[model samples]
Target: MPLRSLLRTIPIEPSPEGEKGGLQRRMGTIPLMMLGIGATVGTGVFFVMHEAVPAAGPATVLAFLLAALAAGLSALCYAEMASAVPASGSTYTYAYATLGELAAVIVAACLLLEYGVSTAAVAVGWSGYLNLLLDNTVGVSFPAILSANPWDSTPGILNLPAVLLVLLCALLLIRGVSESAKVNTAMVVIKVAVLVLFGAVAFTGFQADNFADFAPFGAAGVTAAAGTIFFTFIGLDAVSTAGGEAKDPRRSLPRAILGALAVVTALYLFVAVAAIGSQPWQAFSDPEQQSVGLAVIIENITGAAWPGTLLALGAVISIFSVTLVVMYGQTRVLYSMGRDGLVPGFFARVNQRTGTPVNTTIVVAVAVGLLAAFVPLGGLWDLVSIGTLVAFIVVAVSVLVLRRKRPDLPRGFRVPFGPVIPVLSIITCLVVLSGLGLVTYAWFGAWVGAALLYYALWGRKSAARARARD
Candidate 1:
């Protein structure tokens, strides 16, 4: 196991802008940043606040900063690597180009959980926001029997809305990247508008007393909350996966990645401060506010239904975009894996009409939909956090690997302070990763074990065959 088969890396030599038999490059810096924000700022802010706030009390604000530190450093590393290696597949591709085939495959497995499970988790959260919107405006909401998964607190047959959301996003992905990106950009606009509204209204009810018990649970609780909050930043790095589709991969990719991080961090802090200041952190644990976070906070703060209803509507729209972008990242990762012959060819097959990976999109939709429909959302995001943390570690490691191996590689962005920043990235990510519970570690270990087992038996052989043919 120490010395795996082949132990090779997929060659990465930048080619012309619009090479034949490749994904189209239509996205610029703005769209890419929107895509990242669309994916990064959704479920975490929308629903996970209840889960995160209760863990850190009013000091969840600190947790957000901690998670952001890890995310910020990782995004910088991602920018440098994506600029130097213009390839798709996010961490998987970057790791492969810098590390080896086995390492790439392992990262691909982590990405599967990061994007796919995150999509499912976001979809599940989406149903709650959707129900809140419906009940607020139309006087109807999905019954627990229809919206809650089997193992959720309110046991139900299945989460129908979540499965439906995944399917809809998949259909959009199959249509074309341009279409999806355009729609994501529009949703991001709507999302920002509603968040601004929430902040304004919530601040009117702000009380300084809320800060009295800010650190109730102490540093340990803050660390744990940071793990959950880090889940919100899962897709910030997804923008790097668009390297192959970016108009100027070298320049736009780095700017877009950093821009999205800045915007998302600012927005998250704004919302967190407003919500916490408006109400006691203990109120964050109220079951009703768990799924419908911002809306409930505004309603409790303003004593008006309109603001809450409006924010709920925005949550539905914004969360839809999040699920869409994360799903896109998931499919793209598989597409890149297929191109390297670690997976079936169907994954890499692009629809001539749409210029998108239709097969891959559909497969991801089905798999994620099943999970969204059946799996309970309890502690689900920890899985996403673990995966994202490890992948980020890999990115930081890849930066060092490439710098040492290919000092001559052209890079559009560079981490300031050289190895110091990358080293900090690794340390911050590790701290967050350690905050995850033993159950999450157990799950991650099993997943990584299975991936390595598959690699030892099948992936190694398939990749070898693919390399020989190439």
Candidate 2:
């Protein structure tokens, strides 16, 4: 909170990239777009429909549209940060440079839940889709003991597929298997193809009566549903994060974030409409139906399961990529903190072999792996939403702070209407966060407290501030 320390961090100086510590900015516009698509259109599109539609009925489509607006607003603020500060640490670096160390530490905590736990949650969802695909296509499936996690609704011994996927991604990181923009684009194509195929098939079975009770739970339900559906919009930040590597970052950054928002929102709305039209809203909460909404809809329409099987396969592959991207984001944030002396310097240690922060990735893998292996997907998503909402709020505030603190600074992109736009972004985030239960806030508070304690005891003493002075 000291003014001098804050000014020191906020200067638009290029971070000193040591031969071992710097990230390679090899990404271009096309790959950047794919990163947005690949990260955005995963388990959320495949699975969140079941969760949202059931709560808001036919109105869930509106919820998806509304959530997109909120996400887009935050994305705009993020674009300015990314373009003005071309850093690899995403929100962590942005907050540190703008909001000071204490705020950065808090944002880091929220992001751990947002990106880390969300990876675990997505992995669990991917596992279900994987099992469904295998059962329908190959007539072989893992039994309950190996397939379901003990922390799920109807608990099983452990979730083998989910753990396996996490470990697989971890191994890839260890081996330096970076997911390029081309790969992201291909995954997006696969995800959209499967969903389009799903929408086409689902329409054939549409029943007008399925929407009889539109807005069944009224405004409260609509807001609650929006809060849950907001999780699907988490990847919108990928666009903002790309500002550092973007071509004509100021212009291209906004275009990409807004364009991705438009594309993803439309897709989600259409899918929601198709889902409610295909079956009654009440049936959505069924674990069997929710796990494979598109697949089940296809099977019901065709009276054969191949179409459903293929959809599940597409989900399995694309969602795996989502888990990887989310994990990558989480590790990079922690690595940034380490470099800043906010966490341990050990996390900042880049592997000489892979040019990655190897120890950091391992720590993340161990944490995420335990959650994916033992916890249920649904539990993780709510926590992810809370963390993401809080982080978005921080970015929104940072936008205003940076504008006021360094008005002379050259921003590649700027949010229009100055303070008004960011204020609205913060309000939208808070409204969404309000619907979360007390228990969620408790977990969030506990995590924040722990992070602060760590900082006070160790992080502050060994901070870059001390080292720089030395």
Candidate 3:
């Protein structure tokens, strides 16, 4: 095939229309928004505070705001794409429609990092909190070999709890979307309530002194912290992927995307303020406390075990839901690619009875489960952040491309500031991307290169055959 043919664009039809077999539209605005919140509010809130606080001191609050600003801008672009495209592939589908097959393939690679690795990262965090809960409630915990990554300060043979959590969520996902959404809603409630309770209890011990040395490491630290905190906001785009299953997607997609972002940003800022106020920022660096930072802060404030224990319990439960939702996103994106013939047919095969992609879900489960079992949380998070930022950049660019290329297309939601919003979205994502180190970029480049190679040799031929057959 010629390069131009390989880079041909897909029409902007809904996934069901293009593929014939489609996902059920069982999700409304509430469940759609809940999925976003369920995926977004987990590891970042539960685990990132420890890393961010140490990086920026009390100014980590500012880091949260910075991250939210970038995420909000990208989400606006996502809302527009979701409204116009209304497909299951998220940014990949949008890219295929606006950019081309090459861009879509690249976006698929980025999303693999965003959703697949993120599931691993969230599960790792869940393992830590689960250990905290176990130590508090049962007076016992898994040994380092079973619970910690080999490279962690307290090295373990493998992270068993994280692997177990991934498998459990995978099982739940196989049950179906409505069941997953219901579980997600319940987990979101539990996690949000726990954060609210933490804020209320921690505020009692608030001290103004914690703010005196804010930004101790300077603006560089704040920027770097924002990059790390960006991990927490990664799931806001999960709303866009539900376009295929979203009821009244035109209206519900935008509302859910922006609504979930607003809720998550507010909660994050509130929790950051309460956490820094309740304890000195310098103490967040303690390795013993970092794994269960928020819970430890609550324990310090109340001088009791129960409040912290409850928070740990909430983290464990909620992060499990996060892993589930992210893994779901991964499968659906692969399903889209599979349908388009960019991957093997197994990925797009929806289970006849359940209306879900069971094979894709299983593939995602095994891959994510292995990463969770072996990779350290800190490194996993940085990789997720880089992929998310790049994918957001592409979404922002797609908004601009689609507007110029096909103005006749009816859009359910449009960015209020027109091109200015998308331009800023691109700039903000680039700014955050700059904070990631050279090593991360190298890893990302290697991954993308490998993916492109796979496409050149196998995916291109398969996709061309599929197109010719059609």
lDDT of 3 by residue, 156-201 (tens): 8999998899888888888989999999999899889988988899
The Cα error of candidate 1 at residue 25, in Å, is 1.0
Which is superior by lDDT, 1 or 2?
A: 1
RMSD in angstroms between candidate 3 and the native structure over all alpha carbons: 2.8
Clashing pairs in 1: none
- 64: Cα error in model 1, Å: 3.4
After superposition, the stretches of candidate 1 with alpha carbons farther than 4 Å from their true spots are: 1-5, 47-63, 143-145, 150-156, 206-228, 276-292, 377-379
Candidate 2 per-residue C-alpha lDDT over 398-431 given as tens digits, one digit per residue, 9 for 90 to 100 = 8888888888877768888878888999999887
Worst 10 residues of 3 by lDDT: 13-22
Residue 316, candidate 3: C-alpha displacement in angstroms:
0.5
Report lDDT per candidate: 0.86, 0.75, 0.86
Error of 2 at 142 (Å): 3.0
**Count of clashing residue pairs in every prediction:** 0, 0, 1
> What would you estimate as the lDDT of candidate 1?
0.86
